[model samples]
Target: MKHYYGVKVANKIARVMVSSPERSGGQNQYIETPTIEKPSDERSAKLVDLILENITDTYTLESVAEYCMMSVRSFSRNFKSSNAISFNAWLINVRLNYSLELLESTSLTVSEISERAGFHSEQIYRKHFIKKYDIPPKAWQKIFKSPNHN
Candidate 1:
């Protein structure tokens, strides 16, 4: 039923969507961002938006650092200080959460959802999913998608 990225659900959930135009496919990346009381500062807030905006692209710390007009060390320190999470970890969480929503809400194939969630491949996505949730995505989807789930 959601036509676009950044769909908000009831109970205060929201998504922040950013398009990655540099990539050829240029899929929108979404972060199921929770409400934030405040950011550390203006620059930090700006950086978070920038990073989340480009979430689906292949970005190295050095590349993101240069793109942001910052040195690698500065970007790392500032990003860590503000978000309290490393960029890679946050990105993975975002992609996984997005994939979960897709699984529960759509009839998309596992591979399709995995790629849409910006994973390199289904195998890699499965690995991460199993590691994080202790179950494969398909099984998780089955349980949640079933009518009897409670």
Candidate 2:
């Protein structure tokens, strides 16, 4: 069974691939089992869940580490091992995803959405959004609303 985790810290799904032996053997005559790491243990997983639930709040490595009762160094290493991205990168993607959700579902303006999404400014949001998606928020909205319009 394949499990998909919406790793909030990374703002991406961590998919655990479980392929049949036949397929794996066909793909590679000599196959190596890929190693996968889970972001947090049971205790840390709970902390991660809490942080994800309160993503709208101000969050930092120190804050989350304190919440998990771990040192910054240990937390940072574990977080990277599990999520495969730095904390800041994950947070930005999360905020951007949140902003996109708001843009698609709400009538809020860019500034308002940026503020609510914890983005520093509208300009920053636009820059990153365009960089990631190759389209501005406004254009994305139009395209989402009218799928056939091109």
Candidate 3:
């Protein structure tokens, strides 16, 4: 005999199965595994670290290449090859991620967070945030903020 059961908790369902006689080779075949890629090399890893450290600063491809002690052309080529994304895209992602953390952790307004995130203007920050998250930063903050407010 076999039995299957499902329980709902916190608006999500948890499923379980039980059998009088256990079957061999009954693995979770439906589970999905994610593939995580490592940094291609030391240079790419260092670049990522530096960017994260100075995520609030403005940067250009040429300036960043100079800081890395490489020619602009070589830096752009290797950055894309090693990171699997363009430099600008990586920088924007880093800034956005930092902004998200600030929004969730602090009570700062959206405009203040935008300035601290290295965006040139709040409008630009709002546009990018909406594009990436499909919701405004204010709304996102409301959803993620703690529930202890009066």
Best by lDDT: 3
Per-residue lDDT for 1-150 in model 2, tens only?
A: 432221121122122334322233224211111222335477567765665566667788898778778899988887777777776777777677777666665677888988888877899989987876677878756544322222
Which wins on TM-score, candidate 1 or candidate 3?
3
The candidate scoring highest on TM-score is: 3
Where in model 2 is the C-alpha error above 4 Å? 1-38, 146-150
| Residue 25 C-alpha lDDT in model 1 | 48
Q: For model 3, what is the error of residue 87's alpha carbon versus the real structure, in angstroms, after optimal superposition?
A: 0.5
Q: What is the lDDT of residue 51 in candidate 2?
A: 52
Question: Which TM-score value belongs to model 3?
Answer: 0.69
**How far off is residue 102 in model 1, in Å?**
0.7
The local lDDT score (0 to 100) that residue 47 gets in candidate 1 is 58
Model 1 residue 131 lDDT?
Answer: 78
lDDT of 2 at 113: 84
lDDT per residue for candidate 1 within 4-107, as digits (tens), equals 32322321232223342112343432233333434566655665576556656676788767766789898888777877777677668767877877776778
Worst 10 residues of 1 by lDDT: 7-16
